[model samples]
Target: MINMQMRNIGIMAHVDAGKTTVSERILFYTGKSRRIGDVDDGTTQMDWMEQEQQRGITIQSAATTCFWHDTHINLIDTPGHVDFTAEVERSLRVLDGAIAVFCAVGGVQPQSETVSRQANKYKVPRIAFINKMDRVGANYQSVLTQIAEKLHLNPLPIQLPIYENDNFAGVIDLITMQYLVFDESTQGATVIKESIPATYLTSAEEARTAMLDSLSTYSEEIINLLLEETPIPEELLISEIRKATVTRQIVPVMMGSALKNKGIQPLLDAITYFLPDPFELGSVAAKKIYKNKSEDIQVIRSESDDFIALIFKIQQDKESGALCYIRVYAGSIKAGTMVLNVGKDKKERIGKLYRMHARTPEQMNELKAGDVGVIQGFKLAQTGDTITNGAPILLESIQFPEPVISIAIEPKTIADMNKLKEVLTILQREDPTFIHKENTETGQLLISGMGELHLDVITTRARDEFKAQFNLGKPQVSYRESVESSSQATETFERPINGKETFAGLTLSVKASERGSGNKVINGLSNNVLPENYQAATIRGIEAALSSGITLGYPCLDVEVTIEDAVYNEDLAHEVAYQSLGAMLTEKIASNASPILLEPIMAVDIEVPNEYVGDVISKLTSRGGIVLGMDMNESIQIIHAQSPLTKMFGYSTELRSQSQGRASFSMKFSHYEKKLS
Candidate 1:
């Protein structure tokens, strides 16, 4: 049971929805921690990074292993900010299931919706937790309605909140028809089960019946029992609910306030009872190649199958140098074994393996198929590399968003240059979306990330961890250039190189691609004329040319290039000349291709008091934002809009002032649109 009993899950939520605090409670309750850790005081176990502690927010995903009811739970706590959404994306890619925490008052916030959509894209089964129920204005019914309307989820309540006036005492289980309350005297350790309180008996019975009726579709036995008015047993109901949960047909909703230390134990029980195990996901899919033919197939999760593990994350441990985290899918992995990184076509040796709890590493000799563990000394393995013992079977890699904001940074002292480069290189390897580059023309070093906080974390680490002081410049939006019209051009490379004239003629066509598709290079020329090696070189050059825009120095995007025809002599043909000509001809074609600038547009969600709704609307209007929709939830107004990133660099500070510190908001990348002149 220790091997297949494991459940790989993540706790996801919006900012300030108590995701970290809930993680601490789970760790403490499951004996992973001696006492609960607080995020506000910077004592949390999951938010262990120095930056996270100082800012009182989670920036990276932390993984840990604990047990409850003889079931091993491998949990990952992910960041809630939109800037660090890639963290959530990668976590969901490997997890078997998730617990999406929603604030009862601020039900279905922006980031909550964003992460929910991310989970849906991966087909991850999840349960809903109505967190912060202890706070005032915690309307459970409103949040449930929003879940159905906004998240498009089929939600069923498994528990009903028992509130004594404004204070939340406990919850009544709808499945077993019992009242369960946490003991405050024992610090929520003792659970007392008794008869349903007289005040909530009517509502509880109605809820229990409704829950059973909805789940009848999953089990024929339950349907027959309900139709016959027979008393259904608890096991029968739970089994049917588990069936629906594993299939992701319905999301079972539970309520709790993690900050108050109430309603955590039941949530843990729900996780063990409902979420899927690695073995239950049946077979893991991987792309395998045989005889130069590739197909997508499933790899069964079993100890008998060949070893397959995916490197989901990479961190630079202070004492261990490089620490790699992997989810074992097919077979067991042990220390002192060699695995091939099928994506890189390189072999890597597993040195020492460890199970990581936050930043702490515990040495382990082996890990089972469903477990998560770490390894070190993988010099060439990247974040998404697939390591396998069998033939080259590559797992589908995680996709990351491109960086849209950048800033120039330079060492304050010349002695810090090498250290700065080394530090940034390590940071780049850790986060795929974090980009590091140097301007050859001006000799300026620049780092690009998703947002201001992302860049701030990089600079702070450079200063604290590496002790490399640096001066940073102002932030700038990373605009893109795109083709606006179809055009054709022919260029003949008849230049003299090394006292020998290298002549090659190439014709190319350019057209505007759909927005958000990035750039593409289509080879319309016959292979006999252009050949394979030269075509590859030309594509590389086209990619290089797209990095610098015609309107400004920004990168180009959403454009397609086609190689119409080319003439080259095999006796004197060189790939190097075509590479240079490719970059050269791309720029020549852009001169008349009607290039246009595109700026990153963000979808913004704001919640403010009704009194400040007018002010918020006026400010967004001045910043070139159109109000997408507005809704009222009690006294607060929810406003959504699409605004260009250029005008939103420092809008947070201004928004706090506009709403008198009562309004808050979050934004995420929506689409890239043409920038107005």
Candidate 2:
């Protein structure tokens, strides 16, 4: 078996920060590739997708494995764009650590801060890389200061750039007191390690002394050694730095230009030296049910424990059909094994196991704990489903944000309509956030997602991959309905023919709750007037009525309904009569319930040049946005605000035009709020 100490790390950064370029350097230096592929020319090995090449941006996360020294590293290169955040979130969930790349010239931009916040939330240990030192106006020290002040990171520089701008030559490794030069003699390739340059010796020593001072706080022994001016063992100091990083106390910042092929070796060394191994992360926490009836709670740890794996992503490949990507939490998973899907309470047999290599799959016989692999032919398995040995265990399901934007779609032809349902069903299964439901009142097939790009990609996938052609109506703003105040009303629908009589009556009161609480129904009828079964049927009818809004035909939320009174004849009453009466009574209540429109609200983060900050804020306010907060670093400002989704349909293009293509923003669903009168 491979060493359990292997760590899976992800390289994440803001767009145009050279994240993909950094990844390419890592691959090249590690001998994974004979020649480095540049992202500018659309020839990067990791960014292999057609859309990525055409758009000059990463659209999906790519995974690859390489060895640094003796430690095996599974690295994932994630897209920096906000549109592909789902990919980043899933990758973060499985990675042990992350390398956050920041452009030295730009410092920490909008997406960089946003992703940093996400990484902090996930409690993932990270190392910061200040890249692009070869670019003009690149100040490594200024960027480090920005990280400390803006990002609230206690950054200690482990490597310093030797020179800046066009004369950029090498980096001084503070830890080992070595100077590493980038050799362009071999086609702008190869990293050469050598002694520190005479001019940089004093600067390197000063930086190393400062690093030791920073480390002193983490250990009293280090402080004492520093105070006595005693020499500290290099290996011991490296071990302490790793411990501090794992504890999230210190972030070792390194500087180099990936474009120049400089500082790549030092960064790799820092990764293998500082990042914690999977075994160091301890066992994956999973709730397991005990065999004894008396005990209900148990926690499983490693492969020696009972087998358990959680499916984090699911995809419907064109040729391979359905594939479920899972992270093994405990024990070993093998082919032809029957695992119980604790979420669905169904047993599925794992037909084959494979390791994902980009879009290709390499067959594997078994996978141990802390490994990520794919299982085929498990039709019942889904993303977030927990698979375990028959022993029952309930794991928390993955939570996704509610979609704020929606589009109404329909088949253009009868042939397309015949296959639309199947295609849509598969799409919904792949992405939980992509909701598809038929509106009972309007009979429109509404599809909702995080934003316009998200829905567009899904529609494109449907047409290209599923071979289904359809017409999409103008993207409509998703509106909701809710009651303003409490109100009560009574209605009766009685049908009698030739002495055969069926009678049903109900009195209901509708009250509005806090925004986003959704609708709640209560049965207040006495047993003497109506049975419990009859009241349940009435609740179902009310649910059906509220699903499609009474006004613009959208769903309703944040309203409460109660059946205050009900009467039914035991001999003459039927279930159909109660259902019909409930429907009629609900419509009657809605007529006087004082329903109001609610629009979808989004949490937006905008990063723009200092000159355009005022313009961005003014435009947001003009569009009815509520500026929550503002953060400024260097020449860029990060504006956090909440705005109506309707106003943001084409804002990307507008923002690019207004800012002269120097600004970018990311927005996600926050919560639904009432529209102003």
Candidate 3:
């Protein structure tokens, strides 16, 4: 039986680094499946989505359970594509540890570095896997060296590959001083426990010594013992390894060719022995609500003593209605129990508990601490909502990156309008990064995401899952406008009727602000000229005017506006008329200040063969890109640059053709920069 103390982990990697193959091998060896699923055939159990099968790439993170050496292991396989980075981000939020995969031939790819940075951001302890050691040009030693030099990680190899290319057979475990050989005909792993392989003894000993030397840094006593040439206790060494892993001081790198089933058992053993459990981290961070004497609520941290759970993901099931996935931090949650949603300030009753298996779910009665499970009929629970058993807890919400690409979408026929609305609403709820907004001025429904693939997946989901037909326009870059310099303007609106005149006047000033500071309105009118309520109405009007820009009808940001003076007639003063007049004055001032268009710029990191670096750089520059820096290691070159989103509409196809399928790039929204004349 597997140990109950075991916690869940996630495996993340860049595209085409054999992450799914590794997952498949683990499932096969653990007896969860009778046969392994191959990514080449699009039959991987974790990537069951139709879009994933069609594209042969994982679009959503997949979760599964298995056993390794009497320890229960819950593994979540995350997407490597930059467009679906939200999947990796959400998975890391709940995972206790991770296996970051890097290809032996490619070493650390661009997306690999991206995911590594994300794991570090979440403080997730990780182990490295150098997969595909049997492929041509595969060099395990070079990849391990790259992990230390390029990614800035202290990677100690626990197992050494015995052969390369077609001769690859097994691996030698440094800790156990044993050799594990794979019998392909029997599809089973055999351990040669009696003696070490003579061919690998020298390299294995060197690797073992290196492992011991690295472990010694975690403890002075171990270093002293090593210096004195005394034998260190195995238990003490294991304890130090566990401690170093939990503290994220070192990452253990292992090599394997999952396709050949070589080195699989050793990798599983390392995971069970080296990875840290959730309880080892003491308590997950959360926030609780405290009621003050004034009947107001305040947020407080709840580490372990409080009952806290955060809703990380939510799905709409066709048969079950809605399923909310939650991660419990401190306490157990039972089915049919009432819990408070501190974020929404509402109460919800859990209908049923389910242990997730990718798209399928297994029914359960309860979920304990440090467990991830799904609850049905949580109407008030959102992606970032907090659930509490005792007092209400208001935890920090998850923040997603902004969308960089956008397209205007409309229903093909009037009959499909209602369906489109329904589909878009559901898609927005499911994907936090997708933004669907109705542009009232332009009469367009704009959908935005990280890139073209991101938006394409949503449209595919709408058609396949929701049965909705829609028309999409060419992708467009989402942009904004702001004032270039400070200026002031005064305007008056007067109406004369029956020889009597009603008048309103206002003076406003516009000033530039720091980038991303957004728009702000300050009211400086005296009470004698305009009442407080009228001043408030004027401020609202100014905000409305600024939102629908004075140029190109885009949103304005990084600017400040102040209403310096105002004149109003008490008899003729009306909220609607005063607000309308203020709106006109704000627009007048904005036009006089000379606004400039600010286009979205993306931070792009590309990894390609050294021979193709020149072509990639030339193509990027042709698209108005500015090269920030270049890094070269071994046979690949990594280029970092900034490019306008408007110039990158079809760059993906160009990049693929330029590198002949030997390159990959990941880009995210960096900032907005003014368009040069």
Candidate 4:
């Protein structure tokens, strides 16, 4: 059961790797648009947001639909910056395949590795598009090598770039053994296929032989033909390559200057030929919950099956309210259908369905299986929520990285306080990585996000889009608290309830767990020690105390708490008394345990020239950075290092001054480490 007529793919790359440009070219060549959109000119359809257009960087993943010949392509253009990594993550969760675009000049950048790892995590097979072949110092071979070395992906080059006097001319299609030259006069709308030139013929043959040799492992027929010295048919080669790609055995590599539109059409053909269709994916594993019991279930990928869709993205529209972007994995869903949101445990009536084209939407009556569309008027639907008609099936929710940075925000005026709160709620619904919480002790509203840029974008939107007036404080590191050693505490809590006195006694022990294991509660007490009704109440109170942390008021992490014993009076002890006793015991252990403050450490990658390497390293080390490793790619020196997020703040500006604007760096949250006194 395979439908070859549909392809759901995403374009991902490092910042400035030209993924958006590739998307723009796809739109123009697919006849979806008559004019090509330019990123520099701020005319690109995929980057439709005003902030994105002004910054010339994609902040959010944008989805659009277009056609390549008879095949319908549902394409998502994802952001490459580290701040927007969650967008790439959620998109990959639902995508059937992806296109990993790499910069020819800046090969294997930090964000490229991040996105590649994300794609790998979701088991989304992807093809490599060596983009920006026309840039100065562009080397597709170097990029290909880096892709294999850094990403650890089996990259089989299917197209060989042809250069004429150090200028990118065209590409030689290895499968067809033909030259592809896009007509510049027609804005690369006309693809001219010619014979491989004499000078490039040998290289093309070598690449083709290498491709066949790699692909032969997937098909015995191809291996037999290669062994017998029989001419392999294009059909056989393509079929074997597609098979390998679908199984993620090998990534078919293509080279192109996406901006110049030299090799886009062939790339489109590769996407349709290699990427898996929904039917090919078969059923997805999910959990069915009924009567407080859960069982594993498979949601079939067919229109006849029960309806199920994953809400991957949520957008707030001024006139229409919330727009929920969904990937329909099971049966069809129509407007006005009553659906159950499994995560929220609420029922919502589907509003209007939309076939979204960036900011524009075309009304649709139904969203069928294997298709991506938007549903409006969902009051309960949020990102990572699974919606179903009645199956009670819960699909795996998308996991987002924790926010590493925070900023204090306050309404500009007392009248704007409610407006700010309302806007924050809307923003949180749209971005899973964005967190806003009220600090009970300080009474300040704190908004946290993945990075500085992430918070900046959110604050801008709150002020401009939602028209909320808010003042922001300086960025701060979102730290956590953890214990270094085990400790035990016992406490008796007594409170007056109604007209009766209630009493309870609890004993608990706290120990450090493995870093990133997070907080876990273990009930060591036998059922006879504590009644089942009060056990849950005690655990909830202990969890709440752990969330408030020890002394610093930061959330606790990597801590294991065990309830050792509980004593309660039959008539005097109630749920409230037990809950209070649990919290008191946890707080008592916090006083005895050797608690430490944990700061977010970042994995930083800096690319600079050899001459500026010493200066950059000196500056980084002065900020308490540790040099992990370094490598030389072409003439650029890439330094891999780790540093505390607290010290690394505003380091980018300093690095620019030190390297005279030649060095560039990217960092992501690596781990939480103990902070020095």
Candidate 5:
């Protein structure tokens, strides 16, 4: 049976695109909260952390549950900033549906494209919302075009913005051919519907016709009705639209200003009507592993199947240890059930289960399939781990990008050393992209992340949340090394340990691959040349060499290594001999391949006033920036450019001073390129 009453959805967008604001409205209108919370006031229910409230940005993903029109919606509000993109990534992996919010003034921003690609990768059906319609220079038509051109999405606009006396008053519902307005007296709780006004009838009819024309492919009856010049039924239009949306053929577009509280109710109605329920998504793919072998399998999305869940997130709780947030895919389990951690290969008992509403939790005796809740008292559960009833099934795990920037950090006082160390451990467990290590040469502690803002957020949390004082050195770019050409090397190892002779011989070749392809190891030797039992040891050694780069001691990328020939002595030579030969030959070949340094390039979008455009461009170009393009929205100028991450460390402050605080920008990792002098 399909569980059509439950929906799993998330709100995702670029920073300052009003994602949290829209979430606040959803909570207030659903009666989960008494009043709407504001981001500027540090009162949003989703951004519960102190750093989030102070910075007015969401630093982590927050999950909650609410009811809309008798439908239970499990909602996740993901972070919009690029630094916390891992939060958005993992959230998208587990979500069946999402709301991709876009700002009306700044259409198709950088991070906006990032989140859209993430949602696309997961095959999550989505509905687009053109938010900030109340802001100046808000162009609904322009944004619609950008969505089609830049995002490569077929945007089906279901509503058209209505302007009365030069103000964003309401919207026209194309499906019902009615004018929908919100009552400010009730904080937009009461929606007022009326016949289309006389002035907007022509435009409304045209839009409704286009909507039906696109949706006609799903239903023959509507195509027949349109051919006969007959009015289409509202039920038929809705049915066809829902079909297209659930299949991800088209993204139903809606317009609203989340801050002004206009057009939110219709968006909520759209969520319930168009978004897919858990049952509609069908079965999930997983791997069944047993006896050192694995096979593909499908886990049915039903409550009667064996218990299975994926822990998508882990949060440390001061009072109750770690909180493992899971989304159940099959069967039902009660509190205190002993579950097997498929990834960890261990068994742990569930101490408590609770349905979370922001920071608060409501205890539950049992959690059923198609539900998202927190499980406590599991010592072995981790992010991306599968928990099952000893089924030996493993689901696909979430992947995060490597950190591209680093900074040296240490506690300000020796008294706070232990506390700071504890904080770092917890943070690393919570976030996969955050990496911390000690420099073997300089003996300095280093922390690396996606960008400078990422490290800033971490240090701020250490001081404010954990009450640990710390200082940071200047930001450093995390460069990578790759070969410029192919090279080959052969090495022979002979050693005597404890009167035992160890001997091994191997030939290795190294070559550069496509940029951003990462490192790969391949075996070209035949079974006669190298036995199957020794391949694992040789490959492991080669991987170890890849991590220890030949040039500058940085990591290696976009490189391929192949083992061509090998000789082993079964009686005298051990695995360590082959491992030593493999590592030695791999490094020698890479060093001979003519290695070069690679740097991270950022795709930057800057919105500045017209007068300061030239100055901004000049400053950016002086820092090795390349101007990609520019767009104009009224008096505001949008500049698109690419610059190295090293030159952008303090660009935000300089831009503010140059533009006199009239310009704002958003940036994200674009790609890695050969470092310029």
Candidate 6:
């Protein structure tokens, strides 16, 4: 029955597309919330962070549960800002489907395309909700065209908007030939279905025909009914659409002004009716080791089967400690159950389970297959960990990009020093993208993240949530070191350990790798001369030595190390001997390889009016920018460029000044390039 009754879904869209608003409406209509909370007022339930409320954007992905009909829907609302794409990434990793929200006026924005690609990567089926239709210049057809052209989607509109004097009234369901108008007096809690109006009949018919024509390719029954001119049963049509959508063959489109309370009920109906139930998605694939060899196999859902789950999110909860949000894939788990964290190779007991609604928690006794719940008592739990009760199975984990910028944060007073360090540890545990480091030479703590806003959010949280008062230092660009040319060196270590002569010799080769291909080391020695464990020790030593570059103490990147040769006394062929020799050779390799500095280049997207195009371009170019692409969006010019991160400091201020505060931009780390001489 879990196969037919569960929908693990999320709400995703670009910023200002009304995703949180739609979520608010869902929570209220489903009785999860007593009253609607508006984002403008900073009272939205899904956006629960103070930074999120003040900035009016979601900073963390929030999960909640509600019922739609007989089906249980676990909805996750994810952030839309480019810096927080990591949150979106981890959420999509565990979700079976999503709701793609599009602004009727803004259409398919840049982030829209980005998230579409992310969904496609995870093969998550989605239904498109055309929102903000009540706004002026809200053209449904225009968005449809953009969805097809920009996102390369097969978009099928199942509902046609009913506009009265350019104001959104309701929607005309194409399949049922009925018009739906929400009860304004009830705040859209009740729906009144009526016959299609005479003026909208032609458009509704055209839309239904278009939808059926596209869905026909996936179902022979639909083709037969369409060819015979027979009335297509709504259930049969919905089944076919569900099949095609779950396979990502097509995206069903629904229209609404979520903030104005229009078309939300039908959208919810579509989610349960069209998205795949967990059992329908069937088994999950995991890697198992047999006879020291790994193979991928399916883990089907069954409460009686072996327990398996993935920890896709980790959050620090005041009431429950670390709330590890798990997506159970194969079996049942409950309090007191002992599960092995296969990724960490450690065992942990499930202390308690919770059903989260933003900051609120509802305690549960157990969770079965395909359910999402939070659990505590896991001190070592981390995002992307696979935990199982029966066997060791490894699932593909989420990959996060390296942090591109860093800042030094020092406590304002001696009393807050330990508090700041403790909170930093908590933040690092919760967010895998957040990296903390210490400047050993200067005795200062440095925190690194994807962008400035990311670091700003962390510091703000450090102050507000943890009460760790701190002062921020200048934002620092994260530089890297790489070999500019191929070079080789040799080192011999002769030492006395425990009154025994320990001698080891090794040769290392350094070669330049393609830009963005991070540091790597490989054993080029023959096992006949060296043991596998000793070679492994050498690799570990090389990795450690590369962490601090030869010049300027930056981390190394885009370089390759090779263990060209090695010789050691059989009696003294120990791990330490090889490791010591390896470290010595790495220093020699760095000196001979012509190590050079590499700086991060960010992919920036800027949108501004035509009048300010020249000014914006001039400012970007002055920051060592290179124009990659440009397009015209209505009256705005969208310029895509790459610039060194060092030159992008205070860009937001300068751009607003250049464009009279009417322009906006988003940027993310792109690639590492050689610093200009």
Candidate achieving higher TM-score, 4 or 5: 4
In order, the Cα lDDT scores of the candidates are 0.88, 0.81, 0.81, 0.91, 0.89, 0.88
| Best of the two (1, 2) by TM-score | 1
For this target, which candidate reaches the highest lDDT against the unseen true structure? Answer: 4
Candidate 5, position 42, lDDT: 99
lDDT (tens digit, per residue) of candidate 4 on 364-402: 999999999999989988898999997689999999999
Per-residue error at 276 for model 3, in Å?
2.3
Q: Considering summed lDDT, which 10 consecutive residues are worst modelled in model 5?
A: 1-10
Best by TM-score: 4
Q: lDDT tens digits, residues 569-644, model 1?
A: 7765667677788888888787679988899998989999999999999999899888999978888899999999
State the local distance difference test value for candidate 1.
0.88
The lDDT, on a scale of 0 to 1, for candidate 3 is 0.81
- lDDT preference between candidates 1 and 3, better one: 1
Tell me how far the alpha carbon of residue 634 in candidate 5 is from the true structure, in angstroms, after superposition: 3.2
Q: List the residue pairs that clash in candidate 2.
A: 303-331, 518-558
Task: Judging by TM-score, tell me the better candidate of 1 and 4.
Answer: 4
Between candidates 3 and 4, the TM-score winner: 4
Error of 2 at 615 (Å): 5.4
Instruction: In angstroms, give how far residue 312 of model 4 lies from its true place.
Output: 0.7
The lDDT of model 2 is: 0.81
Q: Where does model 4 exceed 4 Å of error? A: 1-4, 498-501, 568-573
Please provide, for model 6 over 1-677, each residue's C-alpha lDDT reduced to its tens digit, 9 standing for 90 to 100: 44348899999999889999999999999899999999999999999988889999999999999998888999999998888999999999999999999999878887888899899989899999999999987888989999999999889889999988777999998878899999999998899999998998887888888888888988899999989999988888888888889888899999998898888899999998899888778577789855566889888877788889999999998767899999988889889899999978899999989989998889999999889999888999999999999888887789888899999889899898888889999999889999887787888999999998988898888888988888999999999988887888777778877777887888899888888667789888878978788888888788877886766788888878899898867886667777877876786778687888999999999988999998899879988999998877667788999999999989999998888899999898888888986
Q: Could you give the C-alpha RMSD of every candidate to the true structure, in order shown?
A: 1.9, 4.7, 4.7, 1.7, 2.0, 2.0
Regarding lDDT, does 4 or 6 come out ahead? 4
